[model samples]
Target: MTTALRILLLDDDPFMLELMTDMLQGMGYENVRAESDARRALAALPEFGPDLLICDLSMPDMDGIEFLRAAAEAHFDGSVVLLSGMDSGILRAAETLAMAQGLSILGACSKPVPRTDLADMLARAWQQREARARPPAHGGVK
Candidate 1:
């Protein structure tokens, strides 16, 4: 919802990847990219320069936490939305761990991801990104 931000969607499930891509396109996002392989997703990260990453936690290639660690090492400052069908507790732990690793963990949600929740998450991430880009203002000294 904020200025055609480049977004990357990574999930081992091809169906989920397609669904999320279509949804993003339907929402008027023109620069959305989907990666079914987590390894490829990592490779694409630098070149894609995405403003956000929506990734699945339980992938065969690389788990979400591992990916988040790599992202952290790579200094990926963009917000991350972790998706999973696992127990809420596990998801919460991943969210907490990702945050501790210094990746902007947005909010973890159970799959199939709720469209409304996804939309809200993206908007919130975009707002934070925009805020970070803006220079702070100061009052004139007397």
Candidate 2:
């Protein structure tokens, strides 16, 4: 069985947060921390320090892209996944911008996150994170 991973899910809607939290739990990720307040989410980050961060595109305090920039300044070295109901094209463009800003964006998905989609994104992010964390092959001892 895959180990349960810590995940921070941020959304402005309370219902969305609850639904996603339940879905994640059902997906075998028991350590999910849900926050309906995007502003509070920023503060919770240092304490939660989740393995992955899932944030909504439109939020009250800070949009997902702005949040990414703030997170980078805070020295958060983890994968960031954006969720939005906006057009895919727009999201893609935003993702490109985030990438240009040196943000470690793992992936993005539409709102009302589906079980299958979340699972796939989580799997890919985990793999990518692991690969990045690995030391370079052929150590300097050569």
Candidate 3:
């Protein structure tokens, strides 16, 4: 079920991008697109129409914060998982900022993320997707 989600991985480091792609593929997520540039990732959003976006916070051209802003402006409604090697406090702050921007933030994690943690996050995201897809419950009035 979760494997059907289209996921976009954005990172400036080519090695990190490849590693993440490999990790996601190993975890049964086949529809994954990796981009080394935030701008290109933003441009690909409309065409890709990913269900989830895994983004690294530290980048040369445009950092993840800026990328999140751009994504919000572009009206991206998918969930976001922020990845960074920065301080935990900084990562938390980014999560807050993303929430404030109306982005459905899945969560944030440090770099070199453990497979277990990644799997857990993905599971939560899948649950959220399922919840969103369900129709609202009706009252007893009917």
Candidate 4:
């Protein structure tokens, strides 16, 4: 079930994009798309309608921050995991900004993200999606 969750990976470095794609597929997630440009990623959002987004902070064109804003404007509802080589402080700031913009941020991690960590994040995202899909319980208050 989790394997069917659509995922989008956005990073400027071609190597990082390839690595992340391989990592996701290795984890049994085959519904994944890799984009090297933020603008192109944004354009693909509507059609892709990803369930999760894994993105990098630093990019030559349209950094992750800007991409977040644009995504918010586009009303993207998928969970986000920020992967960057930047320091912790910057990652924290980006996470906070993303939350403020109403984006569902799963978490942030430094570059060279471990496979276990990525798996954990993906599990969390799947759990969240399941929770959202569940019908609310009604107490015997009526």
Candidate 5:
């Protein structure tokens, strides 16, 4: 059987973290890890090896933007989705930074990212990953 895709969720707010985790689980994402501590979340990357990461932009100690930079530096190739209630100016800057770091950001969404939206993002990320994994038309000869 094919292995389930792993996902990491980083949010300083306990409520948001739990909510997102439950939403992911309800959506049939089995290997979902939620961490309220940004630092710990970063550490879990190697252990979890998640295929996708959803991080809150306004976290406590180390915000999501910083976390994204660190994760990218560590060579994480997973898709990233930034969640925040910040103004568009902040999100625009974050998006630019994410792009410069070569991070595959699914997109930035407003706070309390609806469960339906989360599910859609997860599905899209999964499909994108599958596409990347497919062999080229020329096969191994390419």
Candidate 6:
């Protein structure tokens, strides 16, 4: 079930990105991709068609807020789990902003995120993906 989900991880620090990738792999996700360059990561979204995006909220070229805006504008409907070392209040604000912009935020966590928190976020994202893929229920015409 986990391997079927395509996940894209974005962070400015190459080491952080790699660490995130390893953590994801340890959780049994196979089709995971990590990018240290936010710009390139955004460009890759169309082709990647990821089911879930675990994005860091700060970067040099394009910070996570900009990334969220661009993704929304591009009509990306996939779920997002935002990561940041910023204050909790700031992260919550970003999450709120992302939701207002029509992005599905699965969860947000401060950097050096707890393993259990990340795992829970991934689980929630999977549930969301499954929900989106489900067919709508039928009803009688009005």
Ranking by lDDT: 4, 3, 6, 1, 5, 2
- lDDT of model 6, residue 126: 86
| Per-prediction TM-score | 0.91, 0.86, 0.92, 0.93, 0.89, 0.94
User: What does the lDDT come to for candidate 4?
Assistant: 0.92
**Model 6: colliding residue pairs:** none
lDDT of each: 0.88, 0.79, 0.91, 0.92, 0.85, 0.89
A best-first ranking of the candidates according to their TM-score comes to 6, 4, 3, 1, 5, 2
**Candidate 2 lDDT over residue span 7-96, tens digit each:** 899888889899998888877888889988767788888998777889888887688888877777777777778889988987897788
Residues 67-114 of candidate 4 have per-residue lDDT tens digits of 999999999988999989999999999999999999999999999899
Per-residue error (Å), model 3, residue 90: 0.9
User: What does candidate 1 score on TM?
Assistant: 0.91
Best by lDDT: 4
Cα shift from native, residue 6, model 3 (Å): 0.7
Candidate 3 clashes: the total is: 0
The per-prediction tally of clashing pairs is 0, 0, 0, 0, 0, 0
Point to the candidate with the largest TM-score: 6
Off by over 4 Å in 2: 138-142
Local error of candidate 5 at residue 11 (angstroms): 0.4
Candidate 2 vs 6: which has more TM-score: 6
After superposition, which runs of candidate 5 have C-alpha atoms over 4 Å from their true positions? 1-3, 136-142
> Is 2 or 5 the stronger prediction by TM-score?
5
lDDT of 5 at 34: 88
**Candidate 1 local Cα displacement, residue 98, angstroms:** 0.1
